[model samples]
Target: MMKLDFDDWNIHVGAPHPFNARAVPKIDNGTERPDPRRYHDPDFMREEWDKVFARSWLLAGPASDIPEAGDFFTFTIGPESFIVVRGEDGVIRAHYNVCPHRGSRLVTADFGSMDRFTCPFHSWKFDLEGRNLAVTDEETFRPEVLCHGHDLTSVRCEVAVGLVFICMDTDVAPLSQWLAPILPQLELYDIDKMYVVQHRRSDWGANWKGGVDAFAETYHLHAVHPQTQGLMDDRTQIDLWPGGLSRQFVPFAQPASRYPDQETVNPGIQSMLSDAGVDPNEYRGTAAEARHTVQQAKRRRSDELGLGYDRFSDSQLSDSVVYSLFPNVQIGCHPEAIFLHRFLPHADDPNQFTYDTCILYRHVDAPGYRAPAWMGLAEGTDMSGGTRPEVVHTPLGAPPGLGEVLDQDSDLLPIVQAGARSRGFRGPLWSEQEGRLRHFHAELDRRMTAP
Candidate 1:
């Protein structure tokens, strides 16, 4: 019996690779067990809203979602709703969604195009830049009541690497500083050129932090998402940076170390090869080498198709480089496409949160260019950016249509939430594999316990 090359489950264990070496440092996040109460306690949730969400630069949506002037969308966090719109000046701005007159919500739709926002109740209109355009019966109101100027309250809005971000704390650091660690790597994909092909939001019965924890680590993949074992490597390369940011590089187009057969090219690997324009039957390497082979093939195919893959390293071409943006967003970066997942806290309930998933793909005229098979985009998805799909809202118990792995997470997370409330459950005993979770909770503790 021959010992396998990956039998020890240790890969990328020594020095930091050139790709992520810049962000990796010897910052020690103490290994204290995280309190389970933070997941279900209402008071803790409230504290997070005040300290964490309120102060952090949150991902609003992809900038590609609103390309033209007057294009707008809404993002709600806790009790506040924001209108993120592209002004006529081609600047992206965020405004409080309330009408100044009576606090009526100016826009109810998830996305729309409008020259100005008009309140349905009092018919107060505001321009795309959120300036007051018209106030119905303006003479009736006293000047003192309108002394503050009836403009929609604006927040700090910034665009970086093709994503829109808004921060309520005006004094907070610039978005670039907040995203400094991962910005350079994110730029390699040219995500700004990509367009959203699918977007969906679903209500889940779990605290927002709990939802973040679930997606932040792959430690639970063996138990919760067994189906992915054949396609994903559980031995992930975890990298931590300052500001609660972390990422895991999970090898794709390969089987986990625990898989019984390492030599066979499974269907998942075959699909990956086929998507990269490689013929599975012609593949002669072992399952582990499929990733590298696909990387080479993708580079060759990309050059033939005139697609951009030169900036990306070979590993990035075949692995899942998922980055967890502090507080709420997880981005899975790829050369051909990217996956954006946001876990938004429910306004009133600590035990409820909204899970938003958006799949973006760069359009290429070459028929050979295909997004990763793992993206699981449904048939007839509009990759051309001609049509922005309406946001689909799935109820708490219904299917989120987020494909196999995430839908499995949707089903399992609420159960985990329920277990967290049990008297016997003390706290999570995180392993080295779950360092990202520990890193996130450490940052959460730092913010929540700050003076």
Candidate 2:
């Protein structure tokens, strides 16, 4: 085992490594020079999926998702199918889904439970702990040969905020060291205490990066999310971490037209408003109706956690932080839930990508509630044929259903894919606000070119 340390963070490995490389200095400023061809290059994508996607900290199904022993779920990363199961010992383990004896996939379905898993191909039996039990023709096989190094190769699995994360590389670091800067903030949301409220997946025609990059910044909120503009003030502050990740903080929004004085507004909303650059004197000077509305929205958000996004400022909620973790995974935090979005390459075509969105909330209200009706999937922009809605967040207007928002976002992907390769269009121009996206590319370049 080789332990790698990056600053105060620990990359947990068994023993210490001989040497180390500190992360390259942060990019303070640079002109936007994004290459569009990277989004359409098959060679580029293949390498990306191999080097980045395979080894990275990927979200496994939620812990609550497989609360009982023998519970299991199948998920894919890069070209490998991985299975997560809870052992009889009550410990969760993740292993490559392929059978150790043959290449047959171990678990085919989404998620279920059993005391043992029998490979349908050759009837190879494995216990829930991933230990090989018996083979069909055991007498014919040499016992020494049979016992020689046969066991399900387990990957490193850990839990944080109730979300299960697996790393294909056994030498990779622990989740805590990698997630140091934001761990405190994440715990504040008590993600581990939450369970799945709903989950959905969509396939985007554009490159994986296109779909994920779209969610990195709120700079587009004003133009792309007109409905949410009034609720979200453009002046929300963005705080970037040393590692290139960042969080957008939106203090609560109180429309001047609604509130008459700062005293009338809820204390929480008033604090949020002040954080957003509103002066107490100015808040007091606001109209009576506006003040009343601000107070009302504040109470609604406080009481419901995050359900009333339409009523409160998107930035006001402390749990509303999102992280653009280096390459493919994006974690969006809400008071009541945690959503994970992963962009996976479909094939050699960089324009084609597999998008998986998983929303996990807690089972606080009910111990054993079925997944939301929206779980399997709504309509997406693909061969799937089902039509999901595009949800819009508006300040003054009504918010669309979640399905509608997902649908709208899915439709734009293919168009972007086409434009990336079109003769008329040029490459994307990354902006200063897109530090994470830029940092992502810089890291990609660094890893690809590393010795």
Best by lDDT: 1
Clashes of each: 0, 33
Q: Ten residues in a row with the worst lDDT in model 1?
A: 6-15
- TM-score, cand. 1: 0.95
lDDT of each: 0.86, 0.59
Model 2: what TM-score?
Answer: 0.72
Cα lDDT of model 2 by residue, 292-338, tens digit: 34444444535565333343232323324466665677777655456
Stretches of model 2 off by over 4 angstroms after superposition = 1-29, 142-148, 242-244, 250-319, 363-402, 423-426
Tens digits of per-residue lDDT for model 1, 1-451: 9934431453562223468453446556876987889988888888889999999999999998899999999998889999999998999999999998889999999899988999999899999888898888989989998887899999999999999999999888999998888899899889999999888889999988889888888778888888888878888777788999988888899888787778888899999999888999998999877888888988898788776677677778888899999989999998889999999999979899999999999888776687887788888787788999988899988888888888888898899899999998988988777788899999999998888
Which 10 successive residues of model 2 have the least lDDT summed? 12-21
In the order shown, what is each candidate's alpha-carbon RMSD? Answer: 3.4, 11.4
lDDT for model 1, on a 0 to 1 scale?
A: 0.86
TM-score of each candidate?
A: 0.95, 0.72
